[model samples]
Target: MEILIPLTASLVLLLIGYFIGTILEKKHYQSINDREEKFINLPSVTMTYRAASKETDMSKYSKTQLVSGGVVVSIDYFKRFLALLRNFFGGRVSSYETLVDRARREAILRMKEQSSGADMIINVRLETSTISSSAGDSETVDSIEAFAYGTALYK
Candidate 1:
Protein backbone atom coordinates (compact mmCIF):
# COMPACT_ATOMS: atom_id res chain seq x y z
CA MET A 1 0.00 0.00 0.00
CA GLU A 2 1.09 3.65 -0.46
CA ILE A 3 0.68 4.33 3.25
CA LEU A 4 2.90 1.39 4.15
CA ILE A 5 5.82 2.74 2.13
CA PRO A 6 5.67 6.20 3.65
CA LEU A 7 5.17 4.82 7.15
CA THR A 8 8.14 2.52 6.77
CA ALA A 9 10.31 5.32 5.50
CA SER A 10 9.36 7.58 8.40
CA LEU A 11 10.12 4.88 10.94
CA VAL A 12 13.48 4.19 9.34
CA LEU A 13 14.41 7.84 9.40
CA LEU A 14 13.36 8.15 13.03
CA LEU A 15 15.48 5.15 13.96
CA ILE A 16 18.51 6.52 12.20
CA GLY A 17 18.12 9.89 13.85
CA TYR A 18 17.77 8.34 17.28
CA PHE A 19 20.91 6.25 16.96
CA ILE A 20 23.01 9.07 15.63
CA GLY A 21 21.73 11.44 18.27
CA THR A 22 22.48 9.04 21.05
CA ILE A 23 26.04 8.55 19.86
CA LEU A 24 26.64 12.29 19.64
CA GLU A 25 25.19 12.85 23.09
CA LYS A 26 27.46 10.25 24.61
CA LYS A 27 30.51 11.77 22.95
CA HIS A 28 29.62 15.22 24.22
CA TYR A 29 29.26 13.96 27.76
CA GLN A 30 32.65 12.32 27.57
CA SER A 31 34.28 15.53 26.40
CA ILE A 32 32.62 17.48 29.21
CA ASN A 33 33.94 15.02 31.79
CA ASP A 34 37.44 15.21 30.45
CA ARG A 35 37.46 18.99 30.46
CA GLU A 36 36.07 19.10 33.99
CA GLU A 37 38.84 16.86 35.22
CA LYS A 38 41.47 19.07 33.61
CA PHE A 39 40.18 22.08 35.53
CA ILE A 40 39.51 20.36 38.82
CA ASN A 41 42.44 22.06 40.52
CA LEU A 42 42.30 25.41 38.78
CA PRO A 43 40.35 27.31 41.43
CA SER A 44 37.55 27.09 43.93
CA VAL A 45 34.24 28.16 42.38
CA THR A 46 31.27 29.26 44.44
CA MET A 47 27.91 30.99 44.17
CA THR A 48 28.20 32.88 47.44
CA TYR A 49 28.62 36.61 47.13
CA ARG A 50 31.19 36.83 49.86
CA ALA A 51 34.02 34.55 50.76
CA ALA A 52 34.01 33.01 54.20
CA SER A 53 35.87 35.07 56.78
CA LYS A 54 38.30 32.29 57.62
CA GLU A 55 39.02 31.31 54.02
CA THR A 56 41.26 34.16 52.89
CA ASP A 57 42.09 37.85 53.19
CA MET A 58 40.59 39.58 50.16
CA SER A 59 42.98 42.52 50.53
CA LYS A 60 45.87 40.24 49.58
CA TYR A 61 44.46 39.29 46.19
CA SER A 62 44.72 42.89 44.84
CA LYS A 63 42.85 42.10 41.64
CA THR A 64 39.45 40.87 40.59
CA GLN A 65 37.77 40.49 37.21
CA LEU A 66 34.66 39.10 35.65
CA VAL A 67 34.69 35.92 33.61
CA SER A 68 31.96 34.26 31.64
CA GLY A 69 31.27 31.28 29.40
CA GLY A 70 28.37 30.27 27.20
CA VAL A 71 27.28 27.26 25.23
CA VAL A 72 24.46 26.58 22.77
CA VAL A 73 23.08 23.07 22.44
CA SER A 74 20.53 21.75 19.99
CA ILE A 75 17.88 19.16 20.54
CA ASP A 76 17.78 16.12 18.32
CA TYR A 77 14.72 14.93 16.49
CA PHE A 78 14.26 11.98 18.82
CA LYS A 79 14.26 14.21 21.88
CA ARG A 80 11.86 16.64 20.26
CA PHE A 81 9.47 13.83 19.51
CA LEU A 82 9.56 12.62 23.10
CA ALA A 83 9.11 16.15 24.41
CA LEU A 84 6.06 16.68 22.20
CA LEU A 85 4.45 13.56 23.54
CA ARG A 86 5.17 14.61 27.10
CA ASN A 87 3.59 17.99 26.46
CA PHE A 88 0.28 16.38 25.51
CA PHE A 89 0.29 14.12 28.56
CA GLY A 90 1.18 16.93 30.98
CA GLY A 91 4.14 15.21 32.59
CA ARG A 92 7.79 16.03 33.16
CA VAL A 93 9.76 16.43 29.95
CA SER A 94 12.73 14.36 31.09
CA SER A 95 14.12 14.13 27.58
CA TYR A 96 15.19 17.78 27.64
CA GLU A 97 16.73 17.53 31.10
CA THR A 98 20.03 16.12 29.90
CA LEU A 99 20.32 18.70 27.17
CA VAL A 100 19.95 21.53 29.67
CA ASP A 101 22.25 19.88 32.16
CA ARG A 102 24.95 19.37 29.60
CA ALA A 103 24.75 22.95 28.47
CA ARG A 104 25.01 24.24 32.03
CA ARG A 105 28.00 22.07 32.84
CA GLU A 106 29.77 22.94 29.63
CA ALA A 107 29.29 26.62 30.24
CA ILE A 108 30.76 26.39 33.73
CA LEU A 109 33.71 24.39 32.49
CA ARG A 110 34.44 26.98 29.86
CA MET A 111 34.30 29.71 32.49
CA LYS A 112 36.76 27.82 34.57
CA GLU A 113 39.03 27.37 31.59
CA GLN A 114 38.97 31.11 30.99
CA SER A 115 40.11 31.85 34.53
CA SER A 116 42.65 29.13 34.92
CA GLY A 117 45.08 31.30 36.87
CA ALA A 118 42.59 32.80 39.28
CA ASP A 119 42.65 31.97 42.94
CA MET A 120 38.90 31.72 43.23
CA ILE A 121 35.63 32.44 41.47
CA ILE A 122 32.81 33.89 43.49
CA ASN A 123 29.20 34.88 42.98
CA VAL A 124 28.76 32.46 40.14
CA ARG A 125 25.60 32.81 38.11
CA LEU A 126 23.96 30.79 35.36
CA GLU A 127 21.41 31.79 32.75
CA THR A 128 19.58 29.75 30.13
CA SER A 129 17.51 30.68 27.10
CA THR A 130 15.81 28.84 24.30
CA ILE A 131 16.55 29.61 20.66
CA SER A 132 13.96 29.25 17.95
CA SER A 133 14.46 28.32 14.34
CA SER A 134 11.99 28.54 11.51
CA ALA A 135 11.14 25.26 9.88
CA GLY A 136 8.75 25.28 6.94
CA ASP A 137 6.04 27.71 8.10
CA SER A 138 6.47 27.51 11.87
CA GLU A 139 9.08 28.46 14.43
CA THR A 140 10.20 25.93 16.99
CA VAL A 141 12.67 25.81 19.88
CA ASP A 142 15.70 24.28 18.18
CA SER A 143 18.42 24.92 20.75
CA ILE A 144 19.23 26.28 24.18
CA GLU A 145 21.92 28.70 25.29
CA ALA A 146 23.49 28.44 28.74
CA PHE A 147 25.69 31.18 30.15
CA ALA A 148 27.85 31.12 33.28
CA TYR A 149 29.58 34.08 34.88
CA GLY A 150 31.57 34.86 38.01
CA THR A 151 34.17 37.06 39.56
CA ALA A 152 37.73 35.83 39.41
CA LEU A 153 40.29 36.89 42.02
CA TYR A 154 44.00 37.09 41.40
CA LYS A 155 46.97 37.46 43.67
Candidate 2:
Protein backbone atom coordinates (compact mmCIF):
# COMPACT_ATOMS: atom_id res chain seq x y z
CA MET A 1 0.00 0.00 0.00
CA GLU A 2 2.81 2.39 0.84
CA ILE A 3 4.53 1.81 -2.51
CA LEU A 4 1.28 1.99 -4.44
CA ILE A 5 0.69 5.72 -3.96
CA PRO A 6 4.28 6.71 -4.80
CA LEU A 7 4.40 4.44 -7.81
CA THR A 8 1.11 5.78 -9.12
CA ALA A 9 2.23 9.35 -8.58
CA SER A 10 5.49 8.76 -10.42
CA LEU A 11 3.63 7.17 -13.30
CA VAL A 12 1.32 10.15 -13.57
CA LEU A 13 4.19 12.55 -13.62
CA LEU A 14 5.93 10.53 -16.30
CA LEU A 15 2.80 10.54 -18.46
CA ILE A 16 2.38 14.26 -18.02
CA GLY A 17 5.98 14.85 -19.01
CA TYR A 18 5.68 12.61 -22.04
CA PHE A 19 2.52 14.29 -23.36
CA ILE A 20 3.82 17.80 -22.82
CA GLY A 21 7.15 16.96 -24.37
CA THR A 22 5.52 15.37 -27.38
CA ILE A 23 3.31 18.39 -28.04
CA LEU A 24 6.15 20.84 -27.69
CA GLU A 25 8.42 18.74 -29.86
CA LYS A 26 5.79 18.55 -32.57
CA LYS A 27 5.33 22.31 -32.57
CA HIS A 28 9.06 22.86 -32.77
CA TYR A 29 9.38 20.37 -35.61
CA GLN A 30 6.64 22.11 -37.54
CA SER A 31 8.40 25.41 -37.11
CA ILE A 32 11.63 23.85 -38.28
CA ASN A 33 9.93 22.35 -41.33
CA ASP A 34 8.37 25.65 -42.32
CA ARG A 35 11.60 27.55 -41.87
CA GLU A 36 13.51 24.93 -43.81
CA GLU A 37 11.14 25.35 -46.72
CA LYS A 38 11.46 29.09 -46.49
CA PHE A 39 15.21 28.83 -46.94
CA ILE A 40 15.27 25.96 -49.38
CA ASN A 41 16.67 28.11 -52.15
CA LEU A 42 19.69 29.20 -50.15
CA PRO A 43 22.73 27.32 -51.29
CA SER A 44 25.23 25.96 -48.79
CA VAL A 45 28.49 26.18 -50.70
CA THR A 46 31.43 24.03 -49.81
CA MET A 47 35.20 24.34 -50.29
CA THR A 48 34.63 25.68 -53.75
CA TYR A 49 33.23 28.85 -52.26
CA ARG A 50 36.14 28.97 -49.90
CA ALA A 51 38.43 29.13 -52.92
CA ALA A 52 36.20 31.62 -54.69
CA SER A 53 36.25 33.99 -51.71
CA LYS A 54 39.97 34.49 -52.24
CA GLU A 55 39.76 35.37 -55.90
CA THR A 56 40.86 38.78 -57.14
CA ASP A 57 37.25 39.69 -58.02
CA MET A 58 36.24 40.29 -54.42
CA SER A 59 34.39 43.44 -55.55
CA LYS A 60 31.61 41.31 -57.04
CA TYR A 61 30.28 40.55 -53.62
CA SER A 62 28.77 43.44 -51.70
CA LYS A 63 29.62 41.86 -48.38
CA THR A 64 31.27 38.82 -46.95
CA GLN A 65 30.52 38.04 -43.35
CA LEU A 66 30.64 35.23 -40.82
CA VAL A 67 27.35 33.84 -39.53
CA SER A 68 26.74 31.46 -36.67
CA GLY A 69 23.88 30.06 -34.64
CA GLY A 70 23.60 27.87 -31.58
CA VAL A 71 20.84 26.54 -29.38
CA VAL A 72 20.54 24.38 -26.29
CA VAL A 73 17.63 21.97 -25.99
CA SER A 74 16.67 20.06 -22.90
CA ILE A 75 14.93 16.73 -22.65
CA ASP A 76 11.88 16.16 -20.52
CA TYR A 77 12.08 14.14 -17.35
CA PHE A 78 10.35 11.20 -18.98
CA LYS A 79 13.03 11.09 -21.64
CA ARG A 80 15.71 11.20 -19.03
CA PHE A 81 14.11 8.23 -17.29
CA LEU A 82 13.93 6.28 -20.54
CA ALA A 83 17.55 7.10 -21.31
CA LEU A 84 18.55 5.78 -17.93
CA LEU A 85 16.76 2.54 -18.63
CA ARG A 86 18.35 2.29 -22.01
CA ASN A 87 21.75 2.78 -20.49
CA PHE A 88 21.09 -0.06 -18.07
CA PHE A 89 20.15 -2.41 -20.88
CA GLY A 90 22.97 -1.21 -23.17
CA GLY A 91 21.30 -0.27 -26.47
CA ARG A 92 20.64 2.73 -28.67
CA VAL A 93 19.09 5.70 -26.86
CA SER A 94 16.54 6.95 -29.40
CA SER A 95 15.18 9.82 -27.32
CA TYR A 96 18.57 11.48 -27.35
CA GLU A 97 18.50 11.20 -31.12
CA THR A 98 15.56 13.59 -31.48
CA LEU A 99 17.08 15.99 -29.01
CA VAL A 100 20.22 16.14 -31.12
CA ASP A 101 18.36 16.32 -34.42
CA ARG A 102 16.23 19.19 -33.18
CA ALA A 103 19.24 21.05 -31.93
CA ARG A 104 21.22 20.62 -35.14
CA ARG A 105 18.36 21.57 -37.44
CA GLU A 106 17.45 24.58 -35.34
CA ALA A 107 21.05 25.71 -35.38
CA ILE A 108 21.26 25.51 -39.15
CA LEU A 109 17.99 27.35 -39.57
CA ARG A 110 19.19 30.13 -37.36
CA MET A 111 22.43 30.39 -39.28
CA LYS A 112 20.46 30.68 -42.47
CA GLU A 113 18.27 33.38 -40.98
CA GLN A 114 21.34 35.37 -40.11
CA SER A 115 22.51 35.29 -43.69
CA SER A 116 19.09 35.84 -45.17
CA GLY A 117 20.14 37.93 -48.17
CA ALA A 118 23.43 36.24 -48.87
CA ASP A 119 23.97 34.57 -52.23
CA MET A 120 25.55 31.55 -50.61
CA ILE A 121 26.83 30.16 -47.32
CA ILE A 122 30.26 28.63 -47.49
CA ASN A 123 32.45 26.39 -45.37
CA VAL A 124 29.58 25.49 -43.09
CA ARG A 125 30.30 23.46 -39.99
CA LEU A 126 28.38 22.06 -37.05
CA GLU A 127 29.39 21.16 -33.56
CA THR A 128 27.50 19.72 -30.60
CA SER A 129 28.11 19.48 -26.90
CA THR A 130 26.32 18.14 -23.88
CA ILE A 131 25.32 20.53 -21.13
CA SER A 132 25.54 19.04 -17.69
CA SER A 133 25.74 20.09 -14.09
CA SER A 134 28.26 18.80 -11.64
CA ALA A 135 27.77 19.54 -7.98
CA GLY A 136 30.01 17.97 -5.43
CA ASP A 137 30.03 14.27 -6.42
CA SER A 138 27.06 14.06 -8.73
CA GLU A 139 26.69 14.90 -12.38
CA THR A 140 23.48 15.21 -14.36
CA VAL A 141 22.79 15.82 -18.03
CA ASP A 142 20.79 19.00 -18.45
CA SER A 143 20.75 19.83 -22.15
CA ILE A 144 22.52 19.55 -25.47
CA GLU A 145 23.77 22.39 -27.62
CA ALA A 146 24.33 22.51 -31.37
CA PHE A 147 26.28 25.25 -33.09
CA ALA A 148 26.45 26.07 -36.79
CA TYR A 149 28.73 28.56 -38.45
CA GLY A 150 29.53 29.65 -41.98
CA THR A 151 30.61 32.44 -44.25
CA ALA A 152 28.03 34.33 -46.27
CA LEU A 153 28.59 36.23 -49.46
CA TYR A 154 26.24 39.00 -50.48
CA LYS A 155 26.14 39.85 -54.13
Candidate 3:
Protein backbone atom coordinates (compact mmCIF):
# COMPACT_ATOMS: atom_id res chain seq x y z
CA MET A 1 0.00 0.00 0.00
CA GLU A 2 2.80 2.41 0.86
CA ILE A 3 4.63 1.74 -2.44
CA LEU A 4 1.45 2.20 -4.42
CA ILE A 5 0.86 5.65 -2.95
CA PRO A 6 4.40 6.83 -3.69
CA LEU A 7 4.29 5.55 -7.26
CA THR A 8 0.98 7.25 -7.88
CA ALA A 9 2.30 10.53 -6.63
CA SER A 10 5.40 10.22 -8.79
CA LEU A 11 3.26 9.55 -11.85
CA VAL A 12 1.13 12.56 -11.14
CA LEU A 13 4.17 14.78 -10.85
CA LEU A 14 5.56 13.46 -14.11
CA LEU A 15 2.29 14.18 -15.85
CA ILE A 16 2.26 17.68 -14.56
CA GLY A 17 5.80 18.26 -15.71
CA TYR A 18 4.97 16.97 -19.17
CA PHE A 19 1.98 19.23 -19.46
CA ILE A 20 3.91 22.30 -18.44
CA GLY A 21 6.75 21.45 -20.80
CA THR A 22 4.33 21.17 -23.70
CA ILE A 23 2.70 24.48 -22.93
CA LEU A 24 6.05 26.22 -22.73
CA GLU A 25 7.17 24.73 -26.01
CA LYS A 26 4.04 25.94 -27.75
CA LYS A 27 4.53 29.43 -26.42
CA HIS A 28 8.10 29.49 -27.56
CA TYR A 29 7.15 28.47 -31.08
CA GLN A 30 4.48 31.14 -31.24
CA SER A 31 6.90 33.82 -30.15
CA ILE A 32 9.46 32.75 -32.67
CA ASN A 33 6.91 32.74 -35.46
CA ASP A 34 5.81 36.22 -34.58
CA ARG A 35 9.35 37.54 -34.45
CA GLU A 36 10.29 35.92 -37.73
CA GLU A 37 7.23 37.29 -39.42
CA LYS A 38 8.06 40.79 -38.27
CA PHE A 39 11.58 40.61 -39.53
CA ILE A 40 10.42 39.28 -42.86
CA ASN A 41 8.11 42.22 -43.21
CA LEU A 42 10.87 44.76 -42.74
CA PRO A 43 11.26 47.24 -45.61
CA SER A 44 13.75 45.98 -48.14
CA VAL A 45 15.40 47.45 -51.22
CA THR A 46 15.72 45.92 -54.63
CA MET A 47 18.87 46.70 -56.58
CA THR A 48 20.19 46.15 -60.11
CA TYR A 49 18.25 46.33 -63.37
CA ARG A 50 18.86 44.17 -66.41
CA ALA A 51 17.27 43.14 -69.67
CA ALA A 52 18.08 40.49 -72.20
CA SER A 53 19.54 41.55 -75.50
CA LYS A 54 18.46 40.37 -78.92
CA GLU A 55 19.32 36.75 -79.66
CA THR A 56 21.13 37.86 -82.76
CA ASP A 57 23.27 40.30 -80.81
CA MET A 58 25.29 37.84 -78.76
CA SER A 59 27.89 40.49 -78.11
CA LYS A 60 25.40 42.87 -76.49
CA TYR A 61 24.04 40.11 -74.35
CA SER A 62 27.53 39.03 -73.41
CA LYS A 63 28.46 42.58 -72.50
CA THR A 64 25.24 43.21 -70.58
CA GLN A 65 25.76 43.54 -66.85
CA LEU A 66 24.06 45.06 -63.83
CA VAL A 67 25.35 45.61 -60.35
CA SER A 68 23.18 44.74 -57.37
CA GLY A 69 24.07 45.08 -53.71
CA GLY A 70 22.55 43.81 -50.48
CA VAL A 71 23.65 44.25 -46.93
CA VAL A 72 23.85 41.53 -44.34
CA VAL A 73 21.74 43.30 -41.83
CA SER A 74 21.35 40.46 -39.38
CA ILE A 75 23.33 37.45 -38.29
CA ASP A 76 21.71 35.30 -35.68
CA TYR A 77 23.82 32.74 -33.89
CA PHE A 78 21.11 31.96 -31.38
CA LYS A 79 19.83 29.05 -33.43
CA ARG A 80 23.09 27.21 -33.11
CA PHE A 81 23.18 28.27 -29.53
CA LEU A 82 19.85 26.69 -28.73
CA ALA A 83 20.95 23.51 -30.41
CA LEU A 84 24.05 23.42 -28.29
CA LEU A 85 21.99 23.96 -25.20
CA ARG A 86 19.65 21.16 -26.14
CA ASN A 87 22.65 18.90 -26.61
CA PHE A 88 23.85 19.76 -23.15
CA PHE A 89 20.43 18.98 -21.72
CA GLY A 90 20.28 15.65 -23.57
CA GLY A 91 17.17 16.63 -25.43
CA ARG A 92 16.21 16.49 -29.11
CA VAL A 93 16.74 19.74 -31.01
CA SER A 94 13.15 20.88 -31.44
CA SER A 95 14.14 24.42 -30.61
CA TYR A 96 16.50 24.96 -33.53
CA GLU A 97 13.79 24.74 -36.16
CA THR A 98 12.98 28.39 -35.73
CA LEU A 99 16.58 29.35 -36.20
CA VAL A 100 16.86 27.39 -39.42
CA ASP A 101 13.64 28.87 -40.73
CA ARG A 102 14.80 32.38 -39.91
CA ALA A 103 18.11 31.91 -41.67
CA ARG A 104 16.42 30.75 -44.87
CA ARG A 105 13.97 33.62 -44.79
CA GLU A 106 16.74 36.13 -44.26
CA ALA A 107 18.73 34.71 -47.12
CA ILE A 108 15.82 34.94 -49.49
CA LEU A 109 15.07 38.47 -48.40
CA ARG A 110 18.61 39.62 -48.96
CA MET A 111 18.75 38.10 -52.41
CA LYS A 112 15.37 39.45 -53.35
CA GLU A 113 16.39 42.90 -52.24
CA GLN A 114 19.54 42.74 -54.27
CA SER A 115 17.66 41.75 -57.40
CA SER A 116 14.63 43.89 -56.83
CA GLY A 117 14.94 46.45 -59.61
CA ALA A 118 16.47 44.24 -62.20
CA ASP A 119 14.32 43.86 -65.32
CA MET A 120 15.17 40.16 -65.26
CA ILE A 121 17.79 39.11 -62.80
CA ILE A 122 19.52 36.00 -64.00
CA ASN A 123 22.48 33.92 -63.02
CA VAL A 124 22.11 35.08 -59.47
CA ARG A 125 24.79 34.11 -57.03
CA LEU A 126 24.41 34.30 -53.29
CA GLU A 127 27.40 34.45 -51.04
CA THR A 128 27.28 34.15 -47.25
CA SER A 129 30.05 35.30 -45.01
CA THR A 130 30.80 36.45 -41.51
CA ILE A 131 32.18 39.94 -41.85
CA SER A 132 33.18 40.38 -38.25
CA SER A 133 32.64 38.94 -34.83
CA SER A 134 33.50 39.92 -31.31
CA ALA A 135 36.28 37.86 -29.89
CA GLY A 136 35.25 36.04 -26.77
CA ASP A 137 35.05 32.58 -25.36
CA SER A 138 31.28 32.89 -25.21
CA GLU A 139 30.72 34.98 -28.28
CA THR A 140 29.63 33.58 -31.62
CA VAL A 141 28.39 35.13 -34.84
CA ASP A 142 26.73 34.04 -38.06
CA SER A 143 26.28 36.18 -41.18
CA ILE A 144 24.97 35.88 -44.73
CA GLU A 145 25.70 37.75 -47.97
CA ALA A 146 23.85 37.85 -51.26
CA PHE A 147 24.90 38.93 -54.75
CA ALA A 148 22.58 39.35 -57.72
CA TYR A 149 23.56 40.07 -61.30
CA GLY A 150 21.78 40.47 -64.60
CA THR A 151 21.89 42.34 -67.91
CA ALA A 152 20.51 45.88 -67.84
CA LEU A 153 17.90 47.05 -70.33
CA TYR A 154 16.92 50.63 -71.20
CA LYS A 155 14.45 51.66 -73.86
**For candidate 3, which ten residues in a row score worst on lDDT?**
47-56
Pairs of residues at least 3 apart in sequence or in different chains that clash in candidate 3: 49-118, 50-151, 50-152, 51-151
Candidate 1 per-residue C-alpha lDDT over 54-104 given as tens digits, one digit per residue, 9 for 90 to 100: 576778787888999999999788788889889899878998999999999
C-alpha TM-scores of all predictions: 0.88, 0.89, 0.38
lDDT tens digits by residue: candidate 2, 1-155 = 89799999989989998999999999999999999999999976555564865853657888889999999999987998899899999999998899999999999999999998998888889999988886643538669999999999889
C-alpha RMSD by candidate, in order? 2.1, 2.5, 10.8
**Model 1: CA > 4 A from native:** 47-49, 52-54, 134-139
Assess each prediction's global lDDT (C-alpha) against the native.
0.85, 0.88, 0.46
lDDT winner: 2
- Candidate 2: stretches off by over 4 Å: 51-59, 136-141
**How many clashes show up in model 1?**
0
Candidate 1 matches the true fold with a TM-score of 0.88
Local distance difference test, candidate 2? 0.88
Better of 1 and 3 by TM-score: 1
Model 2 Cα shift for residue 86 (angstroms) = 0.6
Q: Report the C-alpha displacement of residue 141, candidate 1, in angstroms.
A: 4.0
Tell me the lDDT of model 3 at 107: 54
